[model samples]
Target: MTETAATNEQISATLVLPYLNHAVRMYEQKYASRADIDAAMRFGCGYPKGPLTVLDELGLDTVHDQLAARYAETGDNLHKPADLLTALVGEGRTGKSDGRGFYTYANGEVIADDETPSADDQPQLRHDIKKVGVVGTGTMASGIVQVFAQAGYDVVFVGRGEDKIAGVIGGITKGLDKLIEKGRSDEATKEAVLGRLTGATTREALADVDIVVEAIAEDLDLKLELFRDFDRIIKQGAILATTTSSLPITQLADATSRPESVIGMHFFNPATVMKLVEVVTAPATGADVNETTLALCAKVGKVAVSCADRSGFIVNALLFPYLNDACLLAESGVELSVIDDAIKAEAGFPMGPFQLLDVVGNDVSLAIQKELFAEFKEPGFAPAASLEKVVADGHLGRKTKKGFHDYS
Candidate 1:
C-alpha cells in the first residue's frame, strides 16, 4: 500500500476502536437487538454499515486485543473490551474471515440474520391513541406533527404564538406541494393531512388527547415545568412523552403525577424522514406504556428500539463520544481535513467527524458532550478543548459560517 493509504487505514482503525467498544457495551446492556443496533446507525446516522457489522469485518479477536492494549495504556474503562467481545473471541467467532463474529457470514457477506423480536412476541399494545398533541412548532415538532397527521391521528400542535403556528403549517404545506410537483403526493392527501391538525397556544387545549408529545428545547427546567402542567391538565390515562435527546427521562417522569405514563420517544432531526425512534423507558415507566409507545412508533412508520432512560439514549450516547474523540485526535496535531478524509474514505461514514460537528453546530455538540461526561464521569467522555474553544469563539459551525473549518 502507498504510505498515505497505509496512514489512512491506521487512523481509521484508531478512530473506530472506541466506537466499536461502545457498540459492544450497548449490546451487553440489552439496549437493543444486534439487528436493531445495526439498523439504528445505518438508518439514523446514514452509516454505510453498523458498528457491529464493522466489528465483524475487523475481527473480534483483533479488536479485543487492541482494546485490551488501549485500556492498559490509558487506564480508561471506556477502552476496556466489553465482556461480550471477549467471550465471542474466546469462542473463535473471529470475524467475516471465519464466517462468524457479531453476525454469521456466508460467501464473504452477512447472511441477513434478524434478531429483532416481532410485534407478535411483544405484549399487546395497551393504549388506543387516536389523537396526538405536540407541544412545539420548531422544525422537529412540525415534522412530528406532519408524521402523526399523515398516519391518520388528529394532531394538536401548540406554539407560543399564532405566527409560529402559521409558519409550521405553511412550511408543511410547501413541503407537500413540492412532493406533489415531484409526483410523490397529491393535493387530496395534503388536504387530508392538514384537516387532521389543530393549532393552539395553550397547554389546556391538549386535555383530551390520548397522548401529548413535547418536542420543545433541551432545557431541563422548562421540560420539568411542562410535565407538571401536563399532569394537571391532561386526562387520567393519557401518555406524556418527551423528545429530549440527552436529559434523563426518569427525572422528567418524576415531574409528572403519573410517572408510569411518561416515556421518551426520541426522534432524529427531520423526523419526517428518519425511521429510528429510541423508545426510552424510565424506571417508573410501565411495561404497557413501553409496548404502547413501540406500537405508536410502528403506526407512525418508525423503527422503535428500546433503551433505558439514560443521558443520551442509544444514538446520541454512541455518537457524540466518537465525535469528541475526533476533536482530541485533531488536537494531537492531525489535520482536521486529513482525519475527516481518512474516516470517510476508509470507514464509509457519510460525514467525517469534523464535518458532522459543523453540520450539527459546535455549540450543540459541546452541550451534548458535556451531558455524556456528566452522566458517565468517564475521563474519555469529556468534551475536547478544541470543540469548546470553537463554541466559545462563537464559531458555532455552519450556522456561524466558521468552526474547525471556515464555511464562509
Candidate 2:
C-alpha cells in the first residue's frame, strides 16, 4: 500500500477503538440484543456492523488501543471494555484468523450456515412478462403502475369508473413530472413510462396480463370479491398477487379456484420509492408462483423477503406494536410534543411518534390497530381512545388538515 493509504488505515483503526469499547460495554449491559445492536448500527448510523462485530473483525488489540486512548481522554465508563471483551482480547482470540469472536468467519467472510437462508437461493425467475395488470387507482395503485411501466412492462391500470381511471393516470403523470423537474428522469424516459401504462375501467383489461397485482382498499371482503371475479377472467398460470398489508393471504387465496397461484406481494407506501417488498405465501401457493413473484420484485429493483401468510408479516408485525405503545403514551396525558420529543431524543427515531402518527393519518392507524387487536387481543395492541376520538371527529391527518396537531 502507498504510505498515505497505509497511514489513513492506521488512523481509522485508532479512531474505531472508542466506538468499539462503547459497543462492548453496551452489549455487556444487555441494553439490546447483538442482532438489534447490529441492525441499529447499520440502519441508524450506516455502519457495516455493530460495534462488537467490527472490533472482532478489526482485531481486539486494535480496538483496545483506541478504547484505552479514549478512556485516558474522557475517563468515562463508556470507554471501559466489558469483562468478556477484555478476556477475549487478553487471550488474543481475535476475529477471522482465530475462527472466533462475535461471529465465525470462513475465509474472512461471515458464514451463513446458521443464519436463515434467503428465498433468493431457489432460482432466478423467467422475466417473459410483457404485460402486468394492477387493480385499483389509489395512490398506492398509481405508484405500482408507475413502477411497473417504468421498468418497461406493459401495465394495465384497472379501476371501477372512467373518471377514477383518468384520475389515476393524472396522478402518475404528476409524479413523473415531479421526477423530471428534479432531474431524476429525462423526457424520453417519462414518455416511455407513460406509453407502457394503460388505464381500464374493467377487469376485462387483465385478460392478457401475466401477473395481476390487486392494490384495492384494505377490505378483506372487497378484495375477496374482486379475486373471485378476477379468477373467472384472468388467464390460467398467471400469478395472482395482493398489496394488502394486514389481510391474510389464505383468505384472499380461498376466493380463487387456483389457490396455488395466489400470493401476497405487499409493498409499503409510495411503492415506487420503497425498496422492501414482503412476498407472502399462502399454504396452497406453489413454489414456482412464489419464485416468480420474488423474481418480479427484484426485476423492479425491490428487495423481497418471503414470509408465511401471517398478520403484519415481518416489518409491520414488529413496527406497529412500537407505534401502538407510542399512542398509549400520548393517551396517558403526556403532551403530544413532549412525547414526540422524548422518543426522538432518547430512542433516536427520525420523527417523534405523534408527528409520525399525524403523517401516517389517524384513520390508517386506527384500522391497523383494530386488525391487530382483533387477531392478537394483546393489551399493548389496544387502540388509543384519543386516536379513536380524532378519527371520529374527522380530523384524519394532513389530508384532513387536522389530527393530533392542527395543520391550519
Could you tally the backbone clashes for each prediction? 0, 0
Question: Relative to the unseen true structure, what is the Cα RMSD of model 1?
Answer: 2.5
Clashing pairs in 2: none
lDDT of 1 by residue, 1-408 (tens): 223444787778667899999999999888777877888888789998899988998889989999999899878788899999999999999999999888888999677557535656764569989889999999999999999998999999999999998998998998889889999999999999999989999989999999999999889999999999999999989999999988888999999879999999999889999998888899999898998998889888988888888787778888999999888878877888999999999988999999999999999999999989998898899899999999999999999999888989
For residues 22-76, write the lDDT of model 2, one tens digit per residue. 4565456554445544544444332445565766767776666666676687575
TM-score of each: 0.94, 0.73
TM-score (C-alpha) between model 2 and the true structure: 0.73
lDDT (C-alpha) at residue 289 in model 2: 89
Q: How far out, in Å, is residue 252 in model 1?
A: 1.4
Candidate 1 TM-score versus the reference: 0.94
lDDT values, one for every candidate: 0.89, 0.74
Candidate 1 whole-model C-alpha lDDT, 0 to 1: 0.89
Candidate number achieving the greatest TM-score relative to the actual structure: 1
